[model samples]
Target: MADLKVNIGHLALKNPVMTASGTFGYGLEFADFIPLDGLGGFIVKGTTLKAREGNDYPRMAETPSGMLNCVGLQNKGVDYFCQHIYPQLKDINTNVIVNVSGSSPDDYAECASRIDALDNIPAIELNISCPNVKDGGMAFGVTCAGAESVVKAVRERYHKTLIVKLSPNVTNIADIARACEAQGADSVSLINTLMGMAIDIEKRRPVLSIGTGGLSGPAVKPVALRMVWQVARAVKIPVVGLGGIMNAHDAIEFLMAGATAIEIGTANFIDPSVTIKVRDGIDRWLDDHGCHSVREIIGCLD
Candidate 1:
């Protein structure tokens, strides 16, 4: 069998297949469908310092080959995760990483610090790039200074494997990635849902309640691949690629584009079993190519 082990900073994944945050819920929700232990890692929903009700109705709308979501960062706050969610997750066999988000630098730091206290949680995916929320989400992700500020603050308080997710709605994504790296980001996940929107022709209004939403699906794969390639080249840390990955072939495309690993997002909504399928597909492809491990193809693009 091909060696599937891959590392994101100090956190090692069995394979280069992980589930995108928000899309996979808290990992426990999908327990009935796919084996959580079989995954490289599963990032939970975006947790904030305080509970957020998120946006209004019609938060999600289906588009051609993709979908738009303005779900915001609706969660019950970090305290709830620690009190209720952590106990159930701490015993899980696989890597249980939290997707941390906040409205301020202090918020991010406090939430991360709390999660760090949990002995079972090994890593965190900082969500300074979410487009769904209005106040903070992607605000800290567009500029280098902004990205560095949030990362720098969290890096001080949170001493775990920190993977900062980057936004695609920027002029120079590579610069943003480098800024995060310089500020002590262990790894960088790219192309976090491109900014997009749709209008209802009849009502002559926007389909989403928030007026705009984050787009994800096969449609954004090419753009995602391009950004992943650029960021991967710009930073020494691992790049977790996700935007519109649907199947194993799409995941492989990301791997060749310089992503150390690929995260399944919209694909999860299509097939709950798609992540496992992608994992198996990657393993089979490696064996077919006579590659002993996934590391051989980490940045094999030519």
Candidate 2:
């Protein structure tokens, strides 16, 4: 079989297929459907400095070819993760990454600092799309300075593979990516759900509780592909692509477009075994195309 190994900063992956944060539910929940180690890595749900109850009811809604959610980064906080969750994942024989989110730069740094103490956890994907409470609720990822501030704070404390997850709502995503890189980001994952809303025409109100939510699924694939391509060219670090990648063909497209690795999100809800399927399908496609390694196709587009 073609070699599927790849790297994101210093974290090596057995393959390029990883389950996205918030969707994979700490990686343990899907153990019945697929082997935990079968994945390149799995990012656990978003964890903050303190416990969050998440948004009110009806936080999710169905879109045409995708889904919208405003889950509000709900989790039991980092201490609980470090105390209860870390032990179970430490010996899993695969990379277990933490998705860190917060309302301010200090919050991000402190949460990352705690996760940095976990020996088995090699990376943290900073979710900067969170509202900046100090900035009147503007997301830290929408502007270069906001993105840099969070990364800078986290970089000083977190030390391992620091990946900044970018927001698609920005004007020039590449500029935002460059800002993260400037602050010592090891990698950048992109297209973290597009901003969208679904209206309940019959009820005469919005379908989601937050009025708007991040969109993800088949409908977003094209836009995500374009953003990955642009940011990959702009940054020197590796790029982790996500947003509607459902199968190997979709994953392969991201690889070719310049992503060193890709994450599977919304698709996991439809098929629990999709990560393994995509990994194997990538190997099959590589062999059929006479390629010796999955890396051969990364940024192969000319």
- Candidate 1 matches the true fold with a TM-score of 0.97
User: Each candidate's lDDT (Cα)?
Assistant: 0.90, 0.95
Candidate with best lDDT? 2
Q: Please give the lDDT score for candidate 2.
A: 0.95
* Local error of candidate 2 at residue 148 (angstroms): 0.5
Q: Model 2: how far is 177 from its true place, Å?
A: 0.5
lDDT of 1 by residue, 87-137 (tens): 999988878899999878888999999999999899999988743244544
- Candidate 1's C-alpha runs over 4 A off are 130-138
| lDDT computed for candidate 1 | 0.90
Runs in model 2 lying further than 4 Å from the true structure? none
